[model samples]
Target: MTRVVLALDSFKGSITASAAAEAVRDGWLSQRAGDDVVLRPMADGGEGTLDAFAAAIAGARRRPVTVTGPDDAATDAAWLLLPDGTGVVELSSTSGIEVLGGQLRPWDAGTVGFGEAIAAALAGGAQRLVLGIGSSASTDGGVGALTALGARFADADGAPVAPGLRGVASAASVDLAGLRALPPGGALVLSDVSNPLCGPRGAAAVFGPQKGLDAAGVVAADAALARLAALVADAAGPAHPGPATPGAGAAGGTGFALLAWGAALVPGSAEVAELIGLDAAVAGADLVITGEGSYDDQSAAGKVPAFVAQAAAAAGVATALVAGRIAADADVSAFTAARSLTDLAGSAEASLADPARWLRAAGTALSRTV
Candidate 1:
C-alpha cells in the first residue's frame, strides 16, 4: 500500500478546501485499495481563509468584531485566537471585496478597521499575530489601517484627512506617535500577492480593475499609492523590500501597508504549509497532490499549487495538480503532471454540477498512473 498526502486549495465557487481534499482521498482509495492518505486542506488567505485556519487550529475561538467594509459601510467580521495567545487576523474579513455586495470601488474602501482588529489583538495580549493579507477591497495604500492604529495623516493644511484611498493621495505628512501603543512584539503578515506598491506593475494597475476601478481609477489609485509611499518614507525613514517587492501588490495595496508596519512577509502558501507540516508529509509520501480552483499564469505567482510543487520538487517527490480549470498558458510541465477536473467531466457545468463526484473520479484516474 502506498502512502499519499493530499493538500489542495478550495475549488472557489465549486468546492471547499476540505471537500476537495476528501474528493482527492476518495479517488486515491478507489484506485489504491490499501493506501494511507493524509488530507490537509489549504487556503491562500482569501475568501476561505477563516475556514481553512479554523480547520488547521484545534480549539481556536472565532471572535467577531465590527469593521468598515468595502463600501464604507459598517460590517462585522471575525478573527481567530488560541488559548496559547496566538491571534490571527484576515484583512478580507474587514475590507474584502466580497463583503462589498459586488460594488468594489477601491477608492472608497478603507483599512481602518483592519488596524482596529490589530489593536484588539494587541489589547488581548496575543503573543503572536498572523495577519492574512488577501481578498481586500480597499486601495487606500494602508492609510486607513495606519489611522486606526493611531497614526495621523494630515493634508498640507495640517488637517486630518478622511480615512480611505482618496485621503491617501492628499497626505502631506504622517505622524507615527501611535507606535508606542502597539503590542510589544513582532507581527507576521501572510500575503499571497507579489506586486509592488507603485509603477506599471504595481497594485493599482494590476488589481484595481477587479475591484471595479476603471483605467482612470487605476491611474488615480496608483498616484495615491505613490503619495502614500512618500508619506510613509518620511515617517518610517525608508521603504521596506516587501512593500516595494514584486509580490507586494496583493490585496489592493494592503501588503504595502503591512510591510510598512514592520510585519514580516512570508509566502501565504508556505506559511500554511509549515503550520500543517506539509513538507514533512510530502517527504514521507509516495506521491503528493495539490491544487487550486483555477490554474493560470497567475498561479505561478505564489499560489498554493506553485508552492506545493516547489516543495515536492525539492524533496524529490512526484507531484500532480488537479484544478477545476486549467488556463491555456499555465506551465503544466512545471509539475510532475497536471490535469483538470473539467477534462474528465466533459464541461465546466457538468463538473460543477457534482464536483465531489467529478473530483473523486478525476483523482482515481490520476492515481492509476502514479
Candidate 2:
C-alpha cells in the first residue's frame, strides 16, 4: 500500500476511534512497514466528538471544567477549544446515560453540566459553539441547560422549577430576562437522529423507554415536553421554530433547545468530517478503512462508517470495514472488504472482553489480505 487512511469510529464501551486507529496502524505496519498510515478518529457528534477534533486539529486544547452531573452531583468534564475558536461541547461527556453507572435517573437526569461546560468555553473566549447532542440521560426538553444559560423555568406559582423533568412538568412560564445572548459567531447543533420533539415519533415516546421510562413514565414525560413546548412557543417568539423538526428530539430535546436559541442543525457525521478535512484525506489515500462497534441497519443512516465509505467511494478510493459484529442486513456491498472482531476472535464474549486484542488480530489479517 502506498498510503492507507484509518478512520474508525468509537467502539462504544470499548476503545476510542483514535486508539483503534493506532492499534490498526501498528498491526498493519508490523506486516507492511513500507506503507504510510494516516489516522483520523471519527464520531457522529457523540461522546468521542472531542477526541475526534483533538486528533484532527493542531493546537486544539482540551479545556477541563467541573460541572454538575445529570444527578445533580459534581463531575469532571472537558470540551474542546479548536484553533479557530470553535468550542465543541459534547452532551455525552457531562449529561449522558453512562454517567449514571447503570442506574436510571429517568426524569431526574438533566443537562446543567453540559451548559456549565459550554459556559466555561464561552468564558474562555470561544468565537462559536458547536454542540454535539447525543447519549443524553434526561427528557427535560433542555430547560435545565437553558436555565444555566440564564433563562428561568418557573412553575405556576412563580417558584423556580426543580431540575430534570420535574421542572419541565411544573413549568408554567419562561423568563428570558437574564438569558445570555449568543456569541457573535453563533452556535451549531450536531445530531444524527432525526426524531421530532413530540408525538409517537417524538423524544419522550421514542427515547424515554431507553432511558428507563415505563409506559406511564413515557406518557408523563411526553406531556411535560408538550407543556415545555408551549412555554417555548410563547416565550421563544418566532412561532417556536423547530419543535417538530428532525433532530429536535436529540439528546432528550436538547436539540430543540439549541434550535430555539437560534442554532443551525446539521448532520453530525458530515459536519464533523468536513471540519476535520476527511474528504481531502480520502482524496489522497490509496485505501480507506472505517468501522464501528456494530454495523447494522443504523449504520446506513448517516453513521460514521457509512459516511466515510461514501466519501471514499466518491473519491474513487477502495474502502474496508472492521467491526465487533456485522448484521446480515448491513449494506456493506460497496466496501472492498469487511472484517469482524467476533469471527477474528472466535467469539462475541472474547471480542467484548478484549476488543483491542481482537481488533489488532483483525488488523493483521487485513494487512495480509490487502
Candidate 3:
C-alpha cells in the first residue's frame, strides 16, 4: 500500500488545478487501487488561486461582487473568505487580461474591479487579506484600483483624471486620506515577479508588452508609473520604498499600491503552500507528484512544482513531474520521473485540446513505472 501524493497546479487555459488533480487521481487509482492517493491542488497566485484555496481550506466561502473590469466593462467576480478570517482575493479573476475576451485595450485597461473585490472582502468582516496580484490586464500604476479604494487621483485643477494609463499620465496629485484602513491583521501581497515599478527591468518594460503595450506605449507607461510613484511619495511623506522594491511592479503596480496600504510582500507559492499545510502532506507520503502548465527554467523560480519538489526532498520522498510541456532546457534532475502531456499526446494541440485525458494518461504511466 504505497502512499502517493499529487500536487498539481492549474494548466492555465486548459484545466483547473482541482480537476487536474482528480483526473490524475482517477487514473492512478485505476492502475493501483490499493495505493493511498491524496489530491492537493496547488497554485502560485495566478488564475487558479481561488480554486486552490477553495479545495484545500475548510469553511472557505466565495463572496461575489460586481465591478469595473479591465476594459471598463461590468464584471462579476468573487473573493474567498476563510474560516480564520483571511480574505483571499485573486486579481486574475477580476482584472486579468483574460477578461478582455481576446481583445486588447492596452491604453485603457485598468484594475478597478480588483480593488472593489478587496474592498468587498474587507467589508464582509475579513480580518486579514491575501491578495494574489497576477495576470493583470493593465499598466496604470495601479491607480485604477487605488481609485476604487477611496484614494483620489486628480489633475492640477482637482478634477479626476481619465481612466487607465491615459489618466495616470496626466495625474498631478493623489489623496490617500480617504483610503480604507488595513484590516486588523494587515494584508499580504503575493506575486511571482520581482521587478521594480519602473526602468529597464521594471513592470512597464518587462510585462507591458504581454498586456498589449507597444514599444512606445511601454516608454510612456514607465514614465507615468514614475510620476505616480513620485506623487505617492509626496502624499505618504517619503520613506516609502515601494517603487523600487522587488515585486512592486506586480500586476501592473498593484503591489506598489498595496505596499503603500501597508501590505507585506511574499512569494506566492511558498505562502500558499504553508497555508495549505503542504509540508505535512508531503512528509507522510511515500511518493509525490507535482506539475504545472509548463515546466521550464522559470519553473524553478518559486513556482508550485519546484516548491512541492523541495518539500518532498526535505522529507526524503521521491518526487515525479508532470507538465503540459517540458521545455528542452528545463532541468528535471529533481524529479525521479518527468512526463509531459504534450509528449504523451504527440502534439501540443492535442494535449491542450484535451488536457484532462492526457493528464490521466500521464498519471497511469507514472503508476506503471512505480
Candidate 4:
C-alpha cells in the first residue's frame, strides 16, 4: 500500500486548507481504499495560518477578543493558544484587507486591532508568540499596532495622534516605555516577504497599490513610513535598525513594529512546517502531494507547495501537485504528477465556483497515476 501525505495550502477564496485536504483525501480513498493517507493542512502565515495551527495542533484553543478594525471600528477576532503556551496571532484576522470589504482606506486603515489581539494573547499567559503578519489592510507603518501595544505616539502639540496614516504623518514623538514586554519564549514573526520598511521596494511602493493607494498616496505613505522609522529608531535607540530589516515591510509594516517590540522575523512556511512536523511526515511517506491556489513563479519562494516538495525531495519521496491553476511559467518539475483544478473543471470560473469538487477530481486523477 502506498503511503501518501497530503499537505495542501488554502485555495485562497475557494477553500480552506483543512477542507481541501479532506476533499482530496475522500477522492484518493475512493480510488485507493487500501492506501495510507495523511492530511496535514499547510499555510504560509497568510490568511489561513490560524486555521492551519488549529487543525494540526491538538487541544489548541481559540481565544476571542474584540479590537479596533482597520476602519477604526470594533471587530471581533480570535487568536490560537496552543497547549504549549504558544499564542498564534494572525494579523489578517483583525486588521486584514478583507475587513475593509471594498471600502479601501489606504491612508486611514491601521493595524491597531492586530496589536490589541496580541496584547490579549499576552494577557492570557502565553509564553511564546507566533505572529502571522499577512493580508494587512493598512499602510500606517504599524503605528496603530504600536499604539495599541502601549507605545504612545503624539503630535508636536503633545496630543495623541489620530488613527491610521494620518496619525503616522503627524506624529512627532514616540514612547516605547509603556509598551508590553515580550513573552518568556519571545516572539517570532511569520512572514514570507523580504521588503524593507521604506523606499521603492518597500511596503508603500510595492503593496500600497493593492491596498487602494494612488500614485500620490503611495508617495505620501512612503514618506509617512520613513518618518515612523525615524521615530522608532529614536525611541528604541539608534542601534534598532528594524526598518531596514528584511520582512520588516510585511503586513503593511507590522513586521517592523513587531521587530521594535523584540520579535524575530522568520520564514513563515518553514517555521510553520517545522511546528506541524512536516519533515517527519514526509520522511515516513512514500509519496507526498502538495498544492496551493495558484502554482506560479512565486510558488517557489517559501510557498507551501515548494517547501513541501523540497522536504519530500530530501527524503527521496516522490511528490505530486494539485492546484487551482498552474501558471504557464510555473516550474512543476518537482512533482512526478501535477494536476490543475482549473484544467480539470475546463475553466477557472467553474473551478473557483466549486473548488472542492474539482479538487476531488484532481485527487482521483492523481490516485490513478499512483
> Quick one: best TM-score, which candidate?
3
Per-model TM values vs. the true structure: 0.89, 0.89, 0.90, 0.89
lDDT per residue for candidate 3 within 1-370, as digits (tens), equals 9999998888877899888988889889889999999888888887899887887788999988998899888999999999999999999989998899779788789888998999999899999999998778888888888888899999988999888888898999999889899999999988867779999978889889878899999999999999999999888776577599988988888889888877898888887788788888888999999998888876775678888898899999999999999999999999999999999999999999999999999999999996
Candidate achieving higher TM-score, 1 or 3: 3
- Candidate 1: worst-modelled 10 consecutive residues by lDDT: 177-186
Better of 1 and 4 by lDDT: 4
**What lDDT, from 0 to 1, does candidate 4 have?**
0.89
Task: Give me the displacement of residue 268 in model 2, in angstroms.
Answer: 2.1
* Model 2: CA > 4 A from native: 327-336, 346-349, 368-370
Could you tell me the TM-score of candidate 4? 0.89
lDDT of 1 by residue, 100-126 (tens): 767766567788778878777777677
Instruction: Name the best candidate (by lDDT).
Output: 4
Off by over 4 Å in 4: 156-158, 327-333
The digit string of per-residue lDDT tens for model 2 on 253-329 reads 99898777778888899987987788988899999999998888657756789889999999999999999999888
List per-prediction Cα lDDT, in the order shown.
0.79, 0.86, 0.88, 0.89
Q: Which ten residues in a row have the lowest lDDT in candidate 2?
A: 233-242
Error at 302, model 1, angstroms? 1.8
